[model samples]
Target: MDNYKFILSGGGTGGHIYPAIAIANELKKRYPNAEFLFVGAKDRMEMEKVPEAGYKIEGLWITGLQRKLTLKNLMFPFKLISSLLRARKIVSQFKPNAVIGTGGFASGPLLKIASGRKVPCLLQEQNSYAGVTNKLLKDAVAKICVAYDGMEKFFPAHKIVKTGNPVREDLIALTGNKKEALSFFELQENKQTLVVLGGSLGARRINKLIEKKIGFFKEAGLQIIWQCGKLYFEEYKKYNSDTVKVMAFINKMNYAYASADVIISRAGAGSVSELSIVGKPVVFIPSPNVAEDHQTKNAMALVNNNAAILVKEKDLDADFDTVFSGLIASKEKQEEISKNIKNMALPNATKDIVDQIEILLKK
Candidate 1:
């Protein structure tokens, strides 16, 4: 426990990277003197986001292979080899007590090298469906932390721990701030509110749906806070008004959740976890473009429990009006979803994940 060193790797998307950061922050609090190094894909968002979070991060020459045939697919082997070699060098020089992965391309090489070097390795798999890199490295890791149940289907039962995904701190503290949140968003308490989230980069389908039906929502007396994402803000910003607020991002996500009576969001693991804690009725629009279409799987876990509703991107045209109008009109359905989703929330997920990692350090 004396001046312990730890290496944590996760990247490519905020879903993976934020969990790694949450874990790192928790570990730093517990082990005040511990050293940390983060490894992320070279051109991925994590390289910028990690340093902004105040941690030293090294980049690996890694990228996921394209599903369709392309020139990038041809460079896959070279990238993999270079990444593995770089990963080995980093692990060997740092000589960390523990290595943790939150599931992205860089984690594949880093954790593989760490496990081979006999360093204790831990994994946090956020999705209901496992990523390819997580599945490939499953057997070698010391402990596997997960957000959902039935993950034994993907990893060894003995090593799997049901610790929910780590969410942003503000969103976790949202339950009590409803009045303040309503004021923050400048919405009326008497009106129903629907919050749309597609993450910062945006979801093309969700944005399109909002554009098509903004008037319908306003006419129905629903106050809307739409985070159309950074990529789509310019195109959709013209829709913003007193009743409808549109932005590239919502810096105060806690307020957004508090102001929301019903939320319409993409079913990424992090968003699902946040929605659960907020304990509000949610409609999940899972992105089909994600690897293995795991977003749908993430949404289904809640749907099966009657905790949330899922509207596939392809089915939005036929299903959105019925599904949305029904939810907005029924107070009973909203309460039922709220109660069920609260039951599924793992509020202490960050603490629980770190508890497992600490145990790994002892072994």
Candidate 2:
């Protein structure tokens, strides 16, 4: 077998895809000749995103089972059987030295099959609370790389590796020159900057709350950089003003993180990782729609430590303005949150994860 022939599996959202890509990138740097393949759900974002990152990907006819009674749940058994068979075929063909899962619907089947074949496999759980897929495959995986603590409540203690989530390298080393970031966004440097992000697909509640309080932001002397996400961009783009910049996506995320004095964001694991490194005071509005309410758990991990503020999605309309205005008014609180969160940043997470991967592969 080759020293490093790796297969990565993850998808459904950028939260899963980006970390899979980050791990792939780190593996490539360490073993230049390493061959990498990605397995993702057929219609998910990773099919397109993996290729864009210069990796080959195979699609499996797999999806998450619905929570309630639906036609999709009726087909769950058939889909699971088909995905297992397909995943086995991919593993048999690739003959990988190791397989890595970043936690998504696709990763569940792919890693399960790989483990069944006696192949070394690792699973990265990005949330404070484990998803059903990861939990189901917990015993099969050789290692469980996790971002949050107290996860021993779910996985085998020996297999757990407490590596913080991997973030984009460019964002990790962000040198936030307020003047430069403001200039790039074409905003005046005199005003305090507030950056709002609602993940890649956008949050409906967050979008509505922002719309209702656009006047409040302007009144607070805050310049805004809002990423409305692709789904709502068309409808919300019209709200863009001289003081507020609206985008479907922001490619230069480093600048966005650097420019802002305060941030309002969803508390996904990837967002938390980036925010920790950026060291900015943030208000985390965890999406209630996510599986197991893990986003709230992620936010609470920081909030309990005084590293961030958590505002529930349901409370955004009523409490967002009051909570946000309080932070903007108090410089002391902002500085304290920023310093505490930065202390929690794991800057060498990629290196740490890669190190563990290499050790497992060697065995």
* C-alpha lDDT of candidate 1 relative to the true structure: 0.92
Locate the minimum summed-lDDT window of 10 residues in model 2: 172-181
* Candidate 2 error regions (>4 Å): 1-3
What is residue 286's positional error in candidate 2, in angstroms? 1.1
Task: Report the number of backbone clashes for model 1.
Answer: 0
Best by TM-score: 1
Residue pairs in steric clash, candidate 2?
Answer: none
Mark the 10 consecutive residues where model 1 has the least summed lDDT: 168-177
Model 1: pairs clashing at backbone N, Cα or C within 3 Å: none
Q: What does candidate 1's lDDT look like per residue over 231-322, in tens digits?
A: 99999999878889998999888788878899999999998998899999999999898888999999999999999999998899999999
Model 2 C-alpha RMSD vs. true structure (Å) is 1.5
**Residue 285 displacement in candidate 2 (angstroms):** 1.1
At residue 224, candidate 1 shows an lDDT of 93
